[model samples]
Target chain A: MKNNFYRAVYCSRCELIGSPETITAELQSILATSRRNNRPAGLTGALLFANNCFAQTLEGEREAVERCFERIQIDPRHSDVTVLEFGPAVERDFTEWSMAFVGDPSATSPDPLAVALFKDIFADNHADSGAKVLLLLRQLVHQEDLWAIA
Target chain B: MNQISSQPPIQTDDQNIARSVIRTTTSDQAAALRESFLVIEDGAILLDARLRVMLCNIPATIRLGHYGAPPSRGYPLTKLIAHSSALDADARTTVLDRCSAMSASDLAGIEARLVFGDIVIRIRRLALGRLLLWVPASRAAGESSLHDPLTGLGNRRVFQAALAAIFTKPNASAALLMIDLDRFKQVNDTLGHPVGDALLRLVGQRLRACLSQEDVVVRLGGDEFAVLLQHLDGVDALGKRLIDLLSRPYLVEGHLANIGASIGIAVAPSDAHDPSTLMRHADLALYDAKAAGRHCIRFFKSELNARAQARLALETDLRRATALNQFALYYQPLVDIASGRVTEFEALLRWQHPSRGIVSPAEFIPLAEELGLIVPIGEWVLRHACRTAATWPADVRVAVNVSPMQFSDSKRLICAVADALTTSGLPGSRLEIEITESVLMHNNAETLETLHALRALGVSIAMDDFGTGYSSLSQLRSFPFDKVKIDRSFVSQIDGKGGSGREVVRAIAALGSNLGMTVTVEGIETDAQADFVETSGGHQMQGYLISHPVPSDMVSALFSPQSPIASAPNPEPVAPAGSRRLRGHDHEK
Candidate 1:
């Protein structure tokens, strides 16, 4: 792992706002599914959402990480994934592994599902986990279409 | 009378009721209602004033047994309640009385919490007759506005309103309890929202179970709840309830989650009279509790708020105290134990508040520190005390008490001391700085380096309030100090009046000698305390017995040969070994 890429993620969900829980839930599922399939590959990423944007950097095995990124980009629940960092990930970037999460206070909880999801994430303290994917999920989770809010 | 009295109940004379029935029902309406009111008598069912099913509703009939005949007629309201064992009969009667007596204008005084299975219902009195209308108070059942959608407890707005009502009631008392879930976000990140929500909902239920009927629990948005306990039973009891409630494991998904609420409470009217103010104070107390540790509960204390308010006032005053020349240094003479002559003086800051007649530094020094004004206040004290004492006799070094903020405040402090020394024309060697052990520990590197730089200017440094810090011996080795002032707490106890002040003074004196620094006993006001220190190998002393802190004008008078407070000319000198062995025991007592 190299220190060059600072290991951070940013994204604008397909919508105008984001939900911290949805992004985190999707990230956890995607990472969990990816890890179950790929051997010797442990995925690590950070999710950040600000000003209606979702961005993150997932780093692990080249193939595992790229596949995770693909899910974030095309998973109808999310869209408009822009890669902010690429290259070898830092060895102790996370020190261990964690989901850095918080509500995009910049935006209110979006829809009933988004609101319920946000409330659940916050109440459970998992608002900070799965943030890598939540950055997009918080915004795109309830949107009827990806490009509508964006 | 009813109009003028705010808390007055609905005044009824027969006119109001008769008028309501006549106006609402009309002359022919009573006949119509008597005929159509029978609509409540369908399917062996009944209706009462509150419209609660006097008999079971159709859906309820399958599970609950039904009543026969015109059920619109009254039955004991208690029989309608399910799971009668959960609540006492007296509680049901009180709910009935309040609801029956109150007009439809208010329901607050007649609400009862009815627990049916796992669901909690808020039942209000129905006005037409003796009846109760029940709705689940929990947000899970669709309560809006009053409850936080997340915590399922009353929201902050409602809590604020509750506090206001409680405070405004004359003779009313309550404790404002603030609760914050510690590190809750960590759970959200590591687990998932589903599990997280499960954890939060569990916490809410647990906290709810901890509350008594007299208590009101409110959720203030995220991870925080305020409980208003009117005439709280006892802090220990409530605290025990919280601990015991959270003691159980919350099963979030497959794994059990662990988290706890840090609670801080301020008693109403005692801590604060205003609602928002009390709420805020409880919040501050809660924050402090959380900072102290999780899974803890603390009651609001006046001293904390006093210290806070005092700090703010002092911080503001200190800035003005310096600019307006309200700061003055009072010197207390440090006597040479053997010569009985004033050799050095400790400089203290006094604030002449226009309204608060001569505010003592003991009360305001801490206030200054809290406000971050200690750095500037300390500099003023150091510079001014040195400037004023510059005219004293050459050997009389002035010791200015320095705060930790000043010592660790970068090299600028060293320069300020130098400036004071240079500007006053007082030799650096003639000035000494007194600092507490905390000053060194707060930021040792800067304090040590700063002390060395001041030493380079020829000023001596003495550790003030020596006994109060940790790892004293190592700290002694780490710093380059010239003297140590035995803490006043120990010196005041030096007399064998109650404890072993002799052994303490001896050990401290021995430590100072071995460390190669002058050992001074401070606050030696009594003759016995002075004799004890000298006999115990203490080298120097400073106290009121030597002389109280005085202005610059009194220094010349006290030290002058023929002045009123001056000691005898050519006072007899005493030796270290002989003085300890033969102190005039008569003079000692």
Candidate 2:
């Protein structure tokens, strides 16, 4: 099978801040769409929002991830266009996702921990932290190494 | 043929000149040989038995010219040689002869000083055929080992000694200026180090030009030069002069360069009497001056020590406070003034310091910001508040106050908000973040993006503490806000007790309405204030009027269903109700 590639981008306006309402709707839509047609191309990684800047690690093949990354730029949600970190080939670090969303839960709230972890940590602002927790979960999930079980 | 026919005419002069040179050690034969002889103006031999000039240089041409013009390029030992025997002669020749004769003997030792003009020539023996070099001792005595090769000025050691002496003298005062050229490294890196070297030399020259004869300059090594100003009455005057000297721009290789001085001043008998102590104090002051901004001058101050101590104290406590779990969140209700209904609450963090007990956000907020701990601390607050609020009624939202530090970063804000929501299982809509008006002043795009990100996740956002910042109309159109909260200042004065408070409130409430934002008034204390807000079409009013910030355990009673309702609500009111201010006063330090 041929491999695919995706290019990352940054938005200047969105870099500063997004109104909670706008961010919420945008994230909900992204999640809903990804959930509808679920597959590896639905893969998305961590999202980090800090210092009026936003960063994320999205994955799948080049086409799928690039399409997702492109929507982030022109979404009218953010504007500044200084791509902080990008590589045409960093490899989709996150393969397990159908548009997982992590955001400031203050905009979203109370649910069971597992479900909240998705909308609260993945698709939104809290994505970075949630990703960290995911990493921990990954460590404990499947392990041929003894360290993983321990 | 043997040695030019056994002690030939030139050979005799060579022997005499070699004898005159003095070598310190017998170990180095080459140096001994090089220094042994003096080339003179006349070719004549001064021997052990007699005295004469030996091994003439070009200067010998002049002497030969005087000897009847060309004198056959040679002179006999007795006729042209002026000096007499060993003792009566111009002693230089006699000493040379004596040294040579000693070196030839089985074992010999001798020393002699023969003066010519201002030069002192010393003679010592090596082997009988050779003598060591003789140089003028006076020139050596006046020479200084501490002179900088390039500047030819006193180095660090000499400056320290001079400063010590100056300090020890009573009534003496001096100021030390430490010149630190800012961005000098850039010049070196960009233009090449050669240019940087030239710039340094140029600075050295310019500084020297600034000093008087009485003042001393020292190249204390690499871009750091010092000037000691004597006869200064006090540090203030000294600092002024030093600043002036360093303020002038220097032209290096046709490039105009500006360098500033962080001058440290010390007055003798006043600041300190010891030289090193004064220098240390001056250095400390210089550090402070640099910290204030480059190009500033400051005098040694004893109070800086106290400030240093205070900074250390604050930094230490900030680190420890979190570990001790000394923090707690307090909630202030946000009432819909028009309806007189409580809709939301603002979460404010307070520290119950073991010693201070209930420190205000104002006191520790800046400290946290400085230490870069506000992000972590804010994350904690957001999570705690969300979790607590999650346990509240479904429609009730908690407003967590976000400082400039907390919201300045998109990544951190995302993490904190996500963590708060995820960990607490609180719905995004139920979680509202309150950011101050000042937060909108910078990096608009980033703030907007972060806000939008948070908002898109179903969270509500509000502009907090309005009317007290650089209020820009553009902010309202650009940033999406569910509500605009008026400052407590205007609310506190709205009873018409103070100047123009009611009018300001009236105007702000109108503005918020015109902009289509839910207007919340903060810090309302009395019923009259509450009444004024209710009449003003304000959407929300919060303060001591309805309920002060209370703990989780008392929330049910504090925000009770139907008590003191100027108006009624759609949902059935829950449990017991009463406004109970804590035993301690509101500590918004």
Task: Provide a comma-separated list of chain B TM-scores, one per candidate.
Answer: 0.53, 0.54
Which residue runs does candidate 2 get wrong by more than 4 Å? A1-150, B1-234, B237-301, B562-589
Per-residue alpha-carbon lDDT of model 1 for B77-126, expressed as tens digits?
44543323434555446544544554243434534444444434444332
Instruction: Give fnat, all candidates.
Output: 0.00, 0.00
Q: Put down candidate 2 lDDT per residue, B147-246, tens digits, no spaces.
A: 5556666666446534643532355566666556656766676667776887676566656654554466778876677777665545465555555544
**lDDT per residue (tens digit) for residues A49-121 in model 1:** 4433444545555545544543443344444333333444445343333333333433454334444433433
TM, every model: 0.45, 0.45
Model 1: how far residue B126 lies from native, Å: 25
Candidates in order have lDDT scores of 0.57, 0.57
True contacts kept of 2: 0.00
Name the TM-score of candidate 1.
Answer: 0.45
Error of 1 at B39 (Å): 51
